[model samples]
Target chain A: MKLTIQNLTYSINDTVIVSDVGLNIKKGEFVGLIGPNGCGKSTLLKNIYRVLSPDAGSIYLDETDIRTMKSKELARKMSVMIQENNVEFDMNVLDMVLLGRYAHKKMLGNMTPEDYEIARKALEEVGMAEYEERSFLSLSGGEKQRILIARVLAQQTDFIILDEPTNHLDIQYQFQIMDILKSQDATVFSSVHDLNIAGYYCDRIIVMKKGRIIHCGAPEEVLTSQIIDELYHIRSEIRENKYTGRKQVYYIPNSANISTCAVTENL
Target chain B: MAAAGFAAMIAAMLLGSVGIQPDWVVKILANHLSRHNIFSPEWEANKEAIIWTLRAPRVVMAYVTGAGLSLCGILMQALTKNSLADPYVLGISSGASSGAVAVICYGWFRFAGAYHIMFGATLGAILAIVIAMKVSSVSNKVTATQLVLAGIAVQAMFSAITNAILYSSTTTSDKLRSAMHWMVGSLASASWNTTVYVLIISLVCTVIIRLFHTELDVLMLGDDTASTLGINLRQVKIGVIVLCTALTGSIVSIGGVIGFVGLLVPHITRSIVGSAHKRLIPASVLTGGFFVVICDMLARILAAPEELPIGVITSFFGAPFFLFLIRKSRNSFGGKNG
Candidate 1:
């Protein structure tokens, strides 16, 4: 599924949050959205996922206007994984995942054997099949993320939108989740805080600042030290790691500049 | 649970101040069901009248009120995505109480006679819900927290008005007693007409709610996720609030403000049957009906000829039992800390 956003604008309380942002993501492309803390990445994604209506412009999934589509119809084509983690009611993993099939269900439809099969298969894909009956609230943060990923897999949409899916996980779990997402056949759009992880996985990166798209390109083209310094207001160097040959960012602390100057004489 | 509710209903009919044998109670019911005249001549006239005409309607009304209120609780909890939400959480009861009190104190709708109180209660409940919705919504989005706070504000305002009416009234003692009993909730005024009306409304609402069982489950995931899953959050919320208001208003109109039954029964049913609405709805209806019948029975028998208010009996027993259940399932009810 191809996603096209054209001049999308959103505002809250008459203050613009997302302003005239546009992008095109081809099918099966692993696209990453990167920006500073309040750069409207999440808001843009929310607009795409139909959580909030855009104040201006249009979004198209393939040739169809998204605004004209019904929620279930759109859900059948796209699935979203948001950062909200609160579960006010106690539900088990299987039950939670089974809810992903809601789009395919009738008003009072019963879950058939096929539905359970799909849910179990999704859990298996996320490597949480063993925890199907476990309470959702009892799971650790990483485990819960995996189960939520499993739920999106059960949704079985052609496109998936993830808002900081790896926000709070450890390195190993973060890589595990990214790896799983990287291997999926669907078109993936994700906003990631860690630039290194984004550099490692994204086929293309779109950078935003103040609700506008500043740059969009491959990792090596858009992740320059100058852009990073200006976007995040920090001094940084982008160096390729000898071990993995991926671009790694190293931030220079205020004192590190003095140390570098002191060592210059020896060099 | 359904069988227990049926048994409790029969027991309620049999154990009033004018006690009748279980056999005779069953025979009268059976005769009524079969439309036969066989047992009509043999049974004592007063016992038959007491069992069939009086206690039967009251017991049936108790069942209808319980089922309807519990179903409302489940819908409210799902709508707000809060386990603590009940039928009265949205200020319906307080609004109804205020209306009923105004009628009782000032003869506001004296021309309606028997239906004046029901009219006031239904109007008040609907008005309260509309105001709450209007106050809480911004940009056409109704959040659970905002809705709850709005309900609280509405409840406080309506309660103050009710108090003002109660304090300023110079009515006779009889009217005061009636108003007080109604506020505390009682089945003393149950009649066949009210019973039939409550039963029909409850049955229709339950069936309609059952159809949206899956939607209710999706709603618990919150608005964003529900919308992403193909649910129109706004439409579902409006539909649920309207249906819940109708069910709750009807219950309040017929049976005053019965507290705790709606709050306690759904939580108990959720724990036993898990959170699937398909099972939860039926289980709640049965358990709620059983609970109210048993509590009404205790209210009748505990004080004998002078019946206790059913609300007092429920709150007294319900509060302790709910505490115990929460203790037992500490992790389930432990919110975010769990």
Candidate 2:
């Protein structure tokens, strides 16, 4: 599935949180959204996933206008994994994953054998097959994140949007999550805070600053030192590692304490 | 569990102050059903009246009220995504109480007679829910915390108003006692008509809620996730609130603020069957029916001549059990671990 956002703008109480932004994600591409905190990466993604309505723009999945499409129809084509992990009830893992099939199931129908089969496969894919009967609240943070990924996989959409899905995971779990997402043959649009993970996994990276897309291209072409400095107000160097041959960003701390105003002026 | 509930209902019917023997009770019921006496021809008229007109209707009312209230609790908890939510949490019982008190003490809506109280309570409940929804909504989104806070505020405000009306009324002690008894919760006024009405409402509401079992399950995951999974949050929230308000309002009109059954029954059911609404709703309904029937029986038998209010018994049992549950699984209620 192809996701096309044209001049998407979102404001909160007369303040523009996400200004006019345009991007087109091709089918089966892995795209990363990287920006400083509060630069509207999550807001822009929320608009695309139907969590927020863009004030004066439109998003389209293939040729269908997303605003006009029914929620179930849009959900059939796209699934979202947000950062929220707090659940009000103590639901078990298998039941939670089975909820992913909600859009496809009939109103009063029971979960068929096929639904359970798909859920089991999704759990297996996330290596959480044994935890199906376990309480979701008792799991560690990373385990819960992986289980949520399994739920999105069970949703079986062609496109997936993730808002910092690996926020609370350890290093190994972060790589594991990214590896699972990388292996899936689906169009993925994820907002990643870690530049290294973004560079290592994404086919293309879109950098946003102050609600506007500042750069868009492959990791090596878009992630220049000047753009990084401009985006984050921090001195940084990007270089290819000898062992992994992937771009890595190394931050350079100031020798002396600098005021926030000075740093902004330098940028 | 269903058999146990049925047995409890039979016991409630048989063990009241006028202890009709099981054989006599069965004969009375059979005669009423078949419209002819097949067993004993010399059955006492008073015993037949007690068995047919009094205990049986009250028992059925107890069951329906329990089923309806607990179903409302389950829906409210899921709607607000808060485990502590109950049928009365949204000021609904207070609203109903105020309306009932107004009708009883001030002669409000005097023309409706037997239905005046019911009409007043239902209208008050709807008003309370609308106020809570309006107060909690921020922009176009409603947060769980805000909804709960709004419910608490509305409840306190309505409760104060109810007390004010009771304090200022110039009615005689008899009317005061009746209003007080109703407010404390009683099945003393249960009749065949009220039982049938409650039974129909409970059945229809439970069936409609059961159809949205999957939607309710997704809703427990939180609003954002529910929307992402194709469940419209606003529409589902409104549907749940309206259904629960109707269910809780009708029961309050008949039973008068029967507390804790709605809050505790769903927890017990969830602990047994997990949190999937498909299994949770049916199990909660049966357990709630059984619990209330047993409690109502105890209320009658505990104080021999004068009946104790059903609400007191439920609170006595429900409060201790609720404390135990909270201690056993603090995190289940989303409480932070110490």
Docking class of 2: medium
Candidate 2 lDDT over A17-128, as tens digits, reads: 9999999999999999999999999999989988889899899999889989877887889999996555758889999899889878876788899999999999999999
Pairs of residues clashing in candidate 2? none
lDDT of 2 at A195: 89
The parts of candidate 2 lying over 4 Å away from their true place are A255-267, B34-38, B100-116, B136-149, B163-170, B319-338
User: How is the predicted docking of candidate 1 categorized under the CAPRI scheme?
Assistant: medium
What is the lDDT of every predicted structure here? 0.83, 0.84
Cα lDDT tens digits, model 1, B4-115, are: 9999999889786676788898889888768897565567888888987899999999998888889988987787666656756567777877777777667888787776
**Candidate 2 local lDDT, residue A50:** 88
Worst 10 residues of 1 chain A by lDDT: A258-267
lDDT of 1 by residue, A1-267 (tens): 999999999999999999998899999999999999999999999999998999999999999999999888999999999865656677788988999998887767877889899999999999999999898888999999999899899899999999999999989899999999998999999999999999999999999999999999999998887899879877676789777788887776666665534543443
What residue pairs are clashing in model 1?
none
